[model samples]
Target: LPAPILRLAAVLITSGLLILGCDENQQGFLLTNRPIVYLGDISYVVYLAHWPTIILWKSVSDSTSLSIFGIFNCLLITFKISIVAHHTIEQFFIRSKVKAVSIVVSLIYGLLAIGLMFNVPATVNTSVASRAASVDVAAAIEWNERVSHNAYRQHRPCKECLDDPEGQRMRGGYTGKGDRFECIWKPDKANGSVKILIIGNSVAHLAISILKPVIEENFPQVELVRLYSMPACRPTEVVQYVCPPYHKALPKQVQAMKPDITMIMYDDAILFITSSKIGQERKILKKTFNKYKV
Candidate 1:
């Protein structure tokens, strides 16, 4: 179902529940029973207090698990806190005749709650400050400066090569083409280059960065080639929003380049597309491998 349809269904269901709640004949029903009514009255306070109480208790007590006694005590504490909050905070606002005074008080309480929510976490875990103190800022700054110049080695973005699937810009301007998203790294000293095509998103780009030195050390003649891979553009013919055109273009590009080795490293999009037929994935893989063959 589409998102709009799902949203409409949710709205209809909630409206139905509201209609039922308003019906006097449904007073004896589970939702309208005395205990349920009282719970509903205090539910707002429970929503505000329960998780924070549990988290604060866990941090202070240094215990992840609660025994039966501990569980009972936690519930008791929560109940007591909720009851106090319901009477003092909730009822005070509800019963107060002065609307402006109530709004001001509520806003003040809300601001206090927001302040505590952010500040309490930092205060609770003092080690966050210690971790910040431990970071070597000078070393980090120096490393950043060194790698900042070579940042282009990660990924190239070019507007001119968008329409041309066969177009590629080789490193060192070996091929006089648009300096586009496609990148081909060739060895300087080697006479011949073994093209290794990488197909995927940022994972493929980062892999190239990490593997470049290792490949250069072991096989100086190897070249690392990367195509313009959008984040979710898996090599397979998966039905995704940003996929169809890129998917169709990929095999043609692979066939044209005829790289000696092809490396396909998709992002987390694979998890979503895994529901697709395994045979379909295999079929795409076989086709891509066939194109890689010289």
Candidate 2:
């Protein structure tokens, strides 16, 4: 396959993994069977060894001079080495030999490793402090309170609203009337800039705060026009749920705003099924992109 096709496939696979990881049920791609459970059994060893194996190979090899063939050869060599190490060394010697004596020995070594991993600053840098300071925490709490009050103001009945009505209403328009939540935008009055439309789901909405400062600093000539939905919805969902009666529909709303660029970030994992279904979605997305010249 082409490099672009391979890149797309990698992206889709990564998205699938993210979805599986985020899923509370831990079913992964296999909803009906226990494939993830089976995989999870050996995942710890794979996780522990794969990174070091890759790093070791890359460290020895001339990565800059590696061609596609060379890369493939490296991968094959790494796979063989990993299989041998896992089956012969890790599984047989470390995991399979779990007698009472071995268990005690393992516990002593395990505690040492854990202590080294956590305590040694030069090894892991465990002393790193959170950027979210006491003031930031207070601000976040204040924001939460505002959102709660806002929810109650909008007559939202969720427990969050009861707790902090003001904050909920201000930040997220969590009115109990519907599933949709309106985004709050505060445009800079001094600098009149062209509106840039932001459309998609929660992820896209989350990007707004991060993007806001960047846009204001870098692209000061542009204003933001946001059209965001909840976690479960996407662009397609916008067409279905948002259109009728609401003056500001989804894509139409975006188009009418006449944004220079439409940035869309959605969770494709919501539509994930089996690997076959994922492949089909990729095909469909490619076709749709081509049809619209997206």
Candidate 3:
């Protein structure tokens, strides 16, 4: 038989046994008497009250573990509360004809819970967007500087920041600093051409070798200035941290080099983690791009 049917059969069999065992007076059973019935009633109280009690306790304490002593304490408190609530609250409510009040209260509580659940995503999105819009490029740059200095204290060179010399030689002898870096290709100082600034993290930086040839072949006479950072630094950080001070200052750096195109790149996974505060980084990136847009 199906599981539900099997479970129903079991319950029916057990109930039949209990009824059969009951005395003609219906005051006692074959297994025990009034004391056993009372104990069973208290056991039901304990089972019903234990879970919510534990949840509330954990929420307040921020604790998940229960030692032997803790378990004893919990049981003591649970039993005391359940006994009082059962007598003063549960029995009163059960005995009362308050069906209408109970139904209305339950409906209100369920509706409120559902409303809060729907509102969560909208709240998160708005908060993230507002935070992003407020980010100042200068402020972000300063934060990055502090973070980078602290990171250096850990005494490990981020391998992602190192340049691949073999990859560089194979692409063509373009000179640049770091493991993944960008160098501008200028034909002449006086000649005006479309400037392309490529920005991204390490993987995007490596792809620059492939991109350089394509750009050169397709768009001849256009000057290409590559701006890149390592690992998974977002474009906002590239502007604030890596590019400014390290690569050179932003507008001044771009203007002096004079480019027509700015290619911004980075790992989407990295951006998702670091740029959780929606608008700030995106705004900074767009602002920087607009400054250099031709």
Highest lDDT among the candidates is held by which one? 1
Q: Write the per-residue lDDT of candidate 3 for residues 169-240, one digit (tens) a residue.
A: 423444334443544344333143455555555534444444444444444544434443443334454123
Error of 1 at 32 (Å): 16
- How many angstroms is residue 204 displaced in model 2 relative to the true structure, after the best TM-score fit? 2.0
Off by over 4 Å in 3: 1-35, 55-65, 101-294
For model 2, the stretches where C-alpha displacement exceeds 4 angstroms are 1-177, 184-186, 189-192, 236-248, 268-294
lDDT values, one for every candidate: 0.55, 0.47, 0.50
Tens-place lDDT digits, model 1, residues 1-294: 334675899799768867878887874595647776798799889888888887777555433334345456777889899999998978877877798667878999999899798897667577675677877978987767533424533433322112332343222212212221355555555444455566764445444554454554555555444444444344553323334455555666666666666667644322111213233433443454334211
lDDT value for model 2: 0.47
Instruction: Tell me the TM-score of model 1.
Output: 0.41
User: In terms of TM-score, which candidate is strongest?
Assistant: 1
What is the RMSD of candidate 2?
A: 17.5
Worst 10 residues of 3 by lDDT: 152-161
